[model samples]
Target chain A: MAGAPNQASLVERLVFRGTRIAALVILVVLVAPMIVIVPLSLTSGTLLIYPLPGLSGRWYEEFFTERLWVQATWNSVLIAVPTTVLATTLGTFAALGLNRLRSRLVPAVAVFLITPLIVPVIIYAVSAFYFYSRLGIVGTYPGLIFGHTALAIPFVVVTVNATLKNFDANLLRAALVLGATPRQAFARVTLPLILPGVLSGGLFAFITSFDELILTLFVASPEQRTLPRQLWSGVQETINPTIAAAAVVLMLVSVLVMLLAEWLRRQGRRIQGKQ
Target chain B: MERADRRRELVGWLLVAPSLLFMAFFFAVPIGAFLLRSVDNTDLVGAMPRTMAEIGGWNGQDLPDESLFMALGEDFTALPDITAAASLGRRLNHNLTGYRSLVMRTFTGLRRHEGPLGREALIAIDKRWSDPAHWRVIQQERSWLTPLYLLASLDLERGPEGIRTIPPERRLFVDLLVRTAWISIAVTLLCLVLGFPLAYVMASSGPRLSSWMLVLVLLPFWTSLLVRTTAWIVLLQRNGLVNQVLERLGLIDAPLTLIYNRLGVYIAMTHVLLPFLVLPLYSVMKGVGGDLTRAAAGLGAPPSTVFRRVYLPQVMPGIIAGCSLVFVLALGYYITPALVGGPRDQMIAHFIAYFTSTSVNWGMAASLAGILLLMVVVLYAALARLVGLDRLKAR
Candidate 1:
């Protein structure tokens, strides 16, 4: 490393500088559009034009007061909360089972479980529409919950599985040998360690259900329109600044979810590192 | 000891059963059923059960015997209602045009006839039925399954001679399939161009800087696709921020047509999918130390050569994984293209949705979806072979 600065050629320096600058410029382009929405959402004007007529919170107020927005928010929460609970419980157990699995079919099982995430959402959405119809749950809250839980389960499985990679099976054995039952062993020894994973999985499931559109489009009735579904139709209209406010609101939820997930990931890593 | 090991294994299987069963019931069976609709032809065969059974014995050129004509009359006359006949005709219409009207008209014609039902009488009812071409479609579709939808999805059809391409005017799905792949490849390349340098910088940076850059990438990465699409509209619409800035800079006298066009689709999709490529590439690059590049430089290899020869191969798996992820995701894109793309720019997924919701044609939708699934599975198998699919886990 000693001769690095001295030995570097002009082409080398120029290329590095160019890449760094290009990277920064692209990051701006990647991130600038979302930041642009905060102002547009705050615009008092009717259109999404620059040189705002003036700064105002009317859009936010409209977003809060409007029935469509309010109803969609409620629907999103109702679906996502149940989806989170169901997906997290089912997926954590699936991961725990997978972690202990010694069968040659483990790879196939994992692949099958993760298929919901890998396959196109449109495929799943269309099929779910048909499947739900067969069950007569096409437009119901329970249908969306079940539909969303399928999509969300894979994320939970992946997260918990990752956390479980660092988990030691002997801990369960030790707890059992100390006169604890299997339930006690799992509760005291394994649960606390995988809490971050479970929470992050739930968070992922929530956001996944919350942000989903295509599936909701197929399975949801007009009465069951969720936040993303509402934004979907609103964006198509392009006549309302209220959509911008809604977009910003959704973006905030996304950012908060991401931060929490990141923190949980780090926490999982920290706990694993200590072990 | 053996019993205990078996018990533990059983416990593992039991724990996995609930999720496995749920996905099977919800996800796998439904998609499998939907895709199978491309070949499903029970309704058509069931509607003309007598005709289907009798037609199997007839030669292609000649009119069927008295039993065949009698069975045909019975099948058409036995119709419980017009809707069943119409629905059967609709199914057959997919195989040969004009079958719907033929079946509906003939159903009424048979209903009115009181005397003997023969081949001549049936032909008198619907003159078009005398032609063997119509009979050929029924003959081919007598089976429980037919390739009508699958053939049509590729813009081909079974004709008098055999399978042949449809007329040029009607050939659409082949182009749409090509367009889907073309757009996906273009987006993947666009992502690679933009993501490479960013990942490079992120990997080479200090811990704090790297994490910050990672957040910069992940925030948009994790944002709802619709939100990102909405953001793009807010920024790229005419008189929007982009055009406003350009106008202020005197770059153009009028606002460019940005949103609702091809350029807009590229920009927004590239933005949405760029992180898929970057995250994996960045993680791969982070694992890839700079020692080799430095060693190459120490040996007098130029930066370009060092990069191409030394560094690129090290991150090849990442490039493959990331690019495939972007390409695969891009192929199934519906909302982005629907929201941003002009009518001329719509992809295969658009038609899949059109057939499902708008046209109410499950056969067409299933066939289109089948084509899409094939494309995805082929790419998936490739990626799974080249770089283990497990390595491309969602972050």
Candidate 2:
């Protein structure tokens, strides 16, 4: 019996070793493409045929010098910023309201909030084009902004709702009993508690609108084209190193935003752990 | 106090009112209109009133009347300039190809018409118009509510006589739908297979390992989709690092067909969508306790039996949530697949885009879109039934 038990332990240890190595290998495989692209973007060659010819920043220079690329970057920022603000505000408020609602309605409200996610984007995008064209707002900024907000709102609802799940209702009662006004209680207690979730939701909203492609293509005119739209047309009509430079910039921005979101989530976890 | 509660409820509704209105107008109404367009007969008769009237009393057995020819001549002569003709041509081209240039030429030739419209005048303008078949098409489409485009969208079309399925050789859209579903399902499965273990590890690991793993997983989320897809192209191309490594390692004799194919599509899409799966799965798994598996093991059960009977049941909800989330997302995927996947691998979204952009067939595009929406709803409903979403989220 001792020998048998010892043999089983040895087998378990070997399995654990194999699984860990496999996990590491999988991580390397997944991360390699992203790592490779960063270096290739710095290549001097016009065509992106691997084993990069030489090192240069000409593509990055071209990206800055080019009029359309600059305009598209500016356009993406314009759309992403306002979209983030709008989606985050609406989504946070909705999440708070839903959290306060009788628990029975939570599932129903959740289903409603998730429609934009469930429906295929192509359908929504095409319909939006027709809908906007009929209203005569197809090529306008507000039109694209609202369109992006609709897409981003779902992310806000999901993220904020997740954060609110852990919230204690008694905290609100405690604050009220302490003679704090309703508004004051929420500002001092509720806001501080859910602030990380709100910020994470906001970051997701910004990245969503920033990275959005399909709907932007439908609604954005040449003058209002977003970064993804410009990159799309660039790929279709012509391939240039400038696109690689733009890709590099987009990669950096996305990574930075996600990193910030991860940091906030960690802080929230730590706070919860301490409690 | 009741009044105050009511007021607060009203404010809550007011806050969400704008978004709801936006979705109703831009999302719901347009889908309704798109479906309506499939059955819309206004344009067929609206464009050619005289021919419509001339063909009203005609039967399907015989050729159309001379009056119909005269109406065609009149309609062609009064047709708008090349731009309008091109737009009309684009609409008709959705039903049948080669009609765009024909319509444009006919419109251009009509600018030089000399006499009152007749058969001779029609023949003089375009010899192709003399065919009875061409006359029959004009007569058939004279109805205000012809179902040509809708039928063609479903691989069926109405001839002068009645509706017929498009020839097998000409069929593409149905195949496109199947391909879309296949790719979406494959991507969903791939995400689950790749993400399940990682999410499990994240849930089960120590803080240091989990945080490091989280950063690695989230790194791709920081980049734009177009950039990530382009990166895959660079890495998977024939002479790219992947192939080069394979070649040097004696894994193959020749550069393998990697990028610009279904394999590339799978690799790139799986990479992009893995995060969606992991985030949801990890969050759900974080709530599941590990003691159950150990408890089962200590009860005189084998490890495999313990995992099957105790562990898998608990993780089912996470798996379902992750699968549905990834599957629905994969269905709408456009940029990644379009850039990496070859022509045959194009999904339904690609055709929706093609019809919207290149073909300009709003009706057909909407019908295809309607089908996609219906598929998602059905799948979602089925998923909800299989594993209740609340149960999934709770786990």
Candidate 3:
């Protein structure tokens, strides 16, 4: 009996060790690509062939000095900022209206709002080209901006609506009973509660517009080329290390913004749990 | 008293009006025009109404009468400017390949024609038109509205008489649509398989562990898609870290083919879309209580059985929602596959972009768009019937 119990303990120990090793292996497997690129991006050679010769920052320098890259980055920001603002504003109001409605209509309204998300972006882009051409808005800032906003609004609606789920209706009732108008109560009570979700949604909107390629392909002319558009053309036209450097910069910016959004979401979750 | 309530309802509509109107004008109107363009017949007959009318009585099966030919020559010569001829040439080009250059070259020749309307003028312009086949095409397509372009877009075309399937070699977009659906379904399944466990851990673990895990999941969301795809290329290439490690361990004799393949496409796409699955699943799982599983276990059930009967049923709605969301997203993926996947692995979005930009075939592009839209609507309806999206939301 003593021998049997000891053997069972030994087997349990081996199993535990194996499970830990498996988890570590999976983590390494997931992270290996990010690890490899850090070294590859620092290679001294002109070409990106493997067994990179040495180390240098010339590609990064070239990225900064290039006029087209600079202009494209500026254009991406110009398109993304206005799109983020419009999507957030419209999405917030839309969420408010949606929340006020009865539960029966909420799902239908959500499906309607999410149509842009569910549809293939390529189809929307093709249609937009014809639509904008007829309206004489094609290849213009307004056209691209509106298109981007439409793409981003669903993100805002989903996030803001999620945040509103935890909101207590009694507060609105309390505010109304205390002589606060509906607008004032919402501004002071509801807006503060949902601001984090709004911010995260806006961040998502910004990312969507900044990285958008298909719609920009249809709506943007050469003069209005955004960073993704420029990157796309560069990839199609030639193989260059400049794109690697641009990728690095874009990755860094997006990671930072995403981290901020994650932090906000965590904060919102904690607040809701408390309420 | 009732006016106040009416005023509030009016304000509610006013608040939502701008977005609704914007969608109608920009989104709805464009889709309508694209649908119209599928059957729009602005070419051939529209370009030469008088000529079409004069030749209307001539049966196209036989060679057109000399009188009809003379009428065409006279109409071609009477054009006050070269622009009309160019427009007619442009209209004909859509029906036949290599016709645009032919039209342009003929327009230049007609500009130099000095003779009266006769066989000499027609023969001088281009000998290609001496064949009756060209005249037959011209007479057949002399209608203001055509089902030809629309039919051709579906890999079916209307010739001199009736509609027929385009040749197998040219039957491209339909296959692409099927391929796109398969890829999207595969990605969605991959997301579900990988994300379910992670989301389960996040929802079931202690707050501290879940928070840390959540941060790791969200980290990839912040990174740019271009960077993520480029990172995969770097890692999966012949002598990259993955191969280096594999070689060191003697896992294989040589670096395996990985990047620029379907496997690479799946890897990069699954990585990018995994977070989409995790988020929705996490939200739904957070609302599920652990007690249901515990109670089932307490009632003489094993751990796996408890998970299956209790937890799995509860989480099915989230699974459906997350899968549909990820599937819809993966179907439209363009840049990732273009960069990572081989030529044959390219999806429908790539072709749509090709037709819109490089090929400049708006009719074909719109028809493809229509097909894609139909596919999404069908998938959404199926999903709605299966899970009913309302139940998928966080309670």
Candidate 4:
């Protein structure tokens, strides 16, 4: 302590404190807008704003009981569940293959696969509108599901590949040396070890499909309207308490999915740390 | 041994085949088909085959001969009444405006006539037929393929002589493109100004504090985009919370017009894209610690000088990566601007969506998308040149 004198002068200290305060304010700016809606949704007033007029359950009742909102929620769930399963399965297999490929072109292939994330959503929407209409699948559930699965597959690949990168090949070799067949080794040893990554990837896929708007806007029909689609129309027509209500519900699902993903990530780290 | 090695390679390929095939069919094919549409013009030739064949032989300077008009009349009478006429008119309107209704009216008059259809008869049906400019449009679109949409997307068009910029009053797309670039640059700069200090603090703080701040950032990342955008509307609209707070504090007599404008767009977009900048910059800053700055201070350099010379240069890669990411995303933004921006404040993407969904102008839509995709690819190539492409993978 004596050897290392106060290197930061008073002016520097003041600037440092100012930056910390500003950073905290920025953090608040980031989180408060999303969290503030929870209280705003509960307001009895018809308008979407702060300062509660009163407390009521009317908006929540509308979100639950209204035919359009309920149908959209159901459609989103229907599409998202299949999207999660399909994208997770395909993306995990692709990641598994990529991990063992030993090719210099792996990065290029990965970039090609993730173009959905890099390219604008409007482009995808336009493409889907054109192709699906030709196939007569426009406004159909399968068409919407296919579009979402393509978009979500990239996220699944990215996360699962990250987890697979640090994985030890020796474990599977050991399982094979123990007289287990290759399939048995994969099922009994590899699958269990990477199950957290797979699950987290699936959760990410689900959230992406659930919150997706543009693809749904292009491919979905009235019967196939998802929650975000409803919210979009809701926003365009009127900014009311009902939208805040829907937003609060959507936020709850997102937070739960996020927490699950965080838990899975930590669990994967712990398992790797143990080895 | 060679057979076994080949078998293993086959197995590896098999595992990856399904996703690749899916992307090729669903992702690659559709975009390929779209890009092709920008230059593919078969609508007029398919609709008015005889007319196209007749016009192909006619000279450009004069009105078509009686033979070409006779062929056009036969082509018109050979088609269904309302749909084909309207469709041809719409297709030709891309080359020459108002040809749609002209073709429609001509079709209706031809349907009611009982005389020989020739050049004079066509001229009597509509005075527009006598104008050589309309014939030029027809001749221009006579081919099965044309670069009209592609040229028009850049606010340029090919006339009798050569390619030239469109009239100043009609020049729109170039302005939209420039505006999109300007807004994206502005947002990127704003994010840097707001995010750099935060990333620095996150990187320099203790592990526990840094992780907490990381969660603060990730919470927004995990939140739904629509949820965040809607929250902005609530906070920024005229009757919204922001104005309410300002008025409650007696800051002004009236609420500011915050939403539905460029200012609103910047506020919302910056909030949405800030985490993108912060996360990458944080990783870079965390890698290069304060040791260098401290060492520079010990060497008698001032704090500002230490930061400028020692710290900032080291983080150039991160800054480039983050800005390029933010800028590219900002250029293609659809939902945020569409929801918050006024008519004059709309970006290129909004117009792209408009042409696709409302106008059903597939050629124009593809052309606009092609221009956008070209811009992004060039930027990425520049990024790859500056920073190795693999570095983007880490981000």
Candidate 5:
């Protein structure tokens, strides 16, 4: 569109139109399944086919009342809460350290810090199974938390690290120069500036651990089953309407998390603007 | 002042120390320890210490001496329980087929020894022991470490002669690794094909339309992977909406096989990974100002020439970054393939899971993990060289 419009020949116009059509088709393919599934989830028919026999909240009610589903929801929260806390704390520190260290080794150190994200999670799941089995913690909440936290930290690190890139180090030094203690300067200046990053990063950590299935498959016992693991088993059993309802519930949770993250990101950009 | 500077840097180190230690212990070391299993012989060496010590002096040409047989008998008796013996048997079975039953039969035979457990007595319990191949397996795994697992991962084995490929029927991991790479490359290309234009559109559109498109992409990105996978399952089933719609449109009387196959995997994986490409490529395209293209057009370059010469080069980093991300992510993918794919569609990750869980074969799991890890690192190194690491981080 920004090119010399008058000089555009018929062939160029055709190519451009062709590309736009392709893009539209791909966009529909990308988003269509998500849209179609929501209505399917609301359909009362036991079958997952289209043209629902009726409309009802029966499946959603079953999702709430089901023993396995309820247990999984609780387990997901149990693991995700501690995972978010531990990851956000440790990851925030990693971000803060790497941001301020002013060392030549930062890139390599950062890479090491984020390798958990880089490596395929299957590797993590298998290794974690071996590691936790030895520690006698594999089936326990603490074990799943440990595994999820390790995996989730990289997400936090990447998110907070990106935010830290926008952070001005002079602000910290300014506070310090004004005779506030190092701790005081950090508490007053640095933490607030990066809180949005930390909160959003925590949301990412929560969703990551929340949606995680592979590690839970290898690490968690039936007693420790999480939402994704349950969905996996449910789908493995059959693609019943109840499974679709479960998926919708899971999707809604992630959507809420995403909106919250987007909000925090906007607030972060606002802070950046004020700076 | 230098002391204060030192103190400040020390604070940075202190801040970083906990996570580094945590990650090293929980992440790196565990992975290292598990991967070490690919070469570890603690199972063998620990199970038969007496036999390992006694067998050291025996010549490879003959069956080991009566003393070695007595030592093996003693080692079998010395095991903590039948399960320990069984575990040892399983490990030996990996080295050579049927060693599990042989070891188990010998362990039971030793328990009911009629007299002195000499070479003759052991041979009577299991006639196969008279053969030198079984003894060779013991001698091979006598060390603190062995390459049996790692070699097996590539479908090679250590014959007395040297390393050679296993029988074609037994050869699996090599093909598995290749298939994983193939599938990942296909998915990456698909993402690039589907995403490049969408990303271009998102970058060039008006703010309102652009944000809407961005939401469409980000919605899937933010949605649960399992949910999207489940959607595909519902939508692609034979009696599902896709087939029904196609039929209503008179496309086919019979519903085409869609789910639980390669086509389904590609469709689901491309949809899942497409955003990863589009988001990064979109940012890169947005950052690529139109001035250069406009200038090139004004200077009489054709649209195609201007796009190729001016626009494409500027967006190369984004393309490289996005493609590499999608490809790498696809390499170790498990869930979508496991659910939507046929047995043939399962990737190396599926086997990694299988070996870890189903067969309880840590050696195979670790070996496969090690090989998969090597592939990822090599691909990452090659791609990092292309666009550098920071562009990946920016994505």
Candidate 6:
């Protein structure tokens, strides 16, 4: 570690070390449960109780083979994919529009766009359940997709808008000044520059839709059940090792997504640095 | 505005049109309609039109005349069957207790009747209806809207006389709201206590170590909520690792009941929300110059005094933002409490979920949700005022 030229007294050094140790401990507390889950999922016994009897892949196998688990994963994918596409496109456009407008309504419009992030999702679930039930779409994919899209849009808007903050409008002007039409300039110049943000925002939307459980509980029927809903019922209904396996898989997917997002973010930084 | 500026505004509006429409349809309209369910009284007025018309003119002192009784009998007999009677009875029972069974039994008696109905015969069929209180309740339900649900949420009930609080034994929603508030407050304080040192360390560290620490913090944020919750269940259950470690070390003779209780809720929620606190605080602390504290220290001030005078005020916005974020999130938390909490530990969100999903009571659900929404709005407003909502959006 590098130190400042100004020397610190014994007390300052002690306080620094103490705070560092405390921070490490807190970090462990935050990360320990996730680390423990992987090994626990490998326990050969049916029960999730700690102190493994032996190690086996039986639960993972069951997760892959069981009709309910398999179908729930498929349902989650089906919902999350459309949610990603829809939320990303709408959020990107809204960010673009906000970037262009310097009106007094900008703050108000931004707040409105982001209210889903602040509102208790239970309210949305109740409201969506009522509306979808009336429309006779309660137990269907489109219903869950629409509800999830509403929840996911704010995340996309926040991310894409953050990226737009650093965006150079003059690049588009340059493209337009060089005989490019507005649409062509946007497609060639703006989209490529902001694609990393757009993709990262889509990843966020995907995760939000994928992990959402409360809304799914309200709006989804048995056939429309997603993975989180399945996990909820599994915990409520039984204490089996299968849930540990599913949880491990869920964490794995989340980690992978995080890595992808981080890479995209670093790439965004690298692109910005190059420019 | 200039022509070019007007064109720009038009383009902006065109771009944002779809999202606005989407919010209006799926968000504003539906939520507005659902909140209206709390005051909706169309079910009763539509089902018992003649009874509503006749009962409107009657005073609360005594039972209505024979004509009103005939109308009541006509409405009850005209109801399709037990289901319709039970439905209307349930609506009326929101205002008056025991009307559900009263309506059901009267409907049964009316089903078997083969002769002309009158006030005397109706009273003979079910004597409870002879009381003016039940008649008053029916009359109160004649309106197209009522305060029954909003009042019920506060553990108050509407009567023929007016609104009054329910018995202490039945008082629940207020307690749930209070409990939810305290639990959220507790979790927010705990996260701040545990997170401040970590965030400080991260903010003060070199770039490489800070980025690595950032990854550690972001790991849980990116992980699935259910996954983290399930991990808590495994670690805190009766025969879980924590218990086994303590027992093996001779710390206790028996395992403590940690999971499925208030303690479990605090631990899990604090863990889940700690990152929220650290991230915002770290970002703010990073923006603050360290020289302020050093300057204070160099000016013959002690370290504690320097921190108290210089450091604390600068991070105040971060504190407010992080607390509001964690506190507001904790208020509506459902999954953690439902999975790990006991019956008494359930928050208002659990009840909202129960009424919305299990019991299918939109009125009760919307009322509870309305109260929860009010809390969120207040906290969000405070957050915006204290930390600036624009800063929150950047995060």
Interface RMSD of each: 1.1, 2.4, 3.1, 1.2, 1.2, 1.5
The list of candidate 4 runs beyond 4 A from truth reads A1-8, B389-395
Q: What is the DockQ score of candidate 3, to 2 decimals?
A: 0.41
Candidate order by DockQ, decreasing, is 1, 5, 4, 6, 2, 3
- Top-TM-score candidate index: 4
lDDT per residue (tens digit) for residues A1-275 in model 6: 23432344567788889999999999999999999888878889887776789999999999999999999999999999998999999988898898888789998998898888888888988898998899888999999998899898888889999998988778878899999998899899889889999999999999999999988988999999999999999988886889989998888889999999999999988886676
**Tens digit of per-residue lDDT, candidate 4, span B145-203:** 88999999889999778999999999999999999999999999999999998998999
Cα lDDT of model 2 by residue, B1-395, tens digit: 98877777776666556656656666667768766776676765676677778776766445556777788778766666666667766656655676777677778877877777776776677786666655566666766676666677778887655777788999987787778889989999888877877787788789899888888887875677787887777778777788888888999999998867899999999998888888878887888787998887777676668768988888777788888878887887888888888988888888888988886777778778777778788888888787765556667
Compute the TM-score of each model's chain A versus the native chain A and list the values: 0.94, 0.90, 0.87, 0.95, 0.94, 0.94
Residue by residue across A1-275, what tens digits does model 1's lDDT show? 66755566655778889999999999999999899888888888888877789999999999999999999999999999999999999999999899877899999999999998778999888888877898999999999999999999999999999888888777878899999998898899899889999999999999999999999999999989999999999988755789989999999999999989988988988876776
Winner on TM-score between 3 and 6 is 6
Per-residue lDDT of model 4, residues A25-78, tens digit only: 998988989888888888898887767889899999999999999999999999
| Clash count, predicted structure 4 | 0
Q: Rank candidates by lDDT, best first.
A: 5, 1, 6, 4, 2, 3
State the DockQ of every prediction.
0.78, 0.49, 0.41, 0.73, 0.76, 0.70
Report the C-alpha lDDT of model 6 over B259-326, residue by residue, as the tens digit.
99999999999999899999999999999998889888777676767778899988888888888899
Candidate 4 scores an iRMS of 1.2
Recovery fraction of native interface contacts for candidate 4: 0.67
lDDT of 3 at B76: 70
TM-scores of the candidates are: 0.96, 0.86, 0.84, 0.96, 0.96, 0.96
For residue B265, what is the lDDT in candidate 4? 93
Interface RMSD of 1: 1.1
Off by over 4 Å in 1: A1-8, B388-395
Measured by TM-score, how close is model 5 to the native structure?
A: 0.96
In order, candidate lDDTs are 0.89, 0.79, 0.77, 0.88, 0.90, 0.89
Q: How far is A8's C-alpha from truth in model 2 (Å)?
A: 5.4
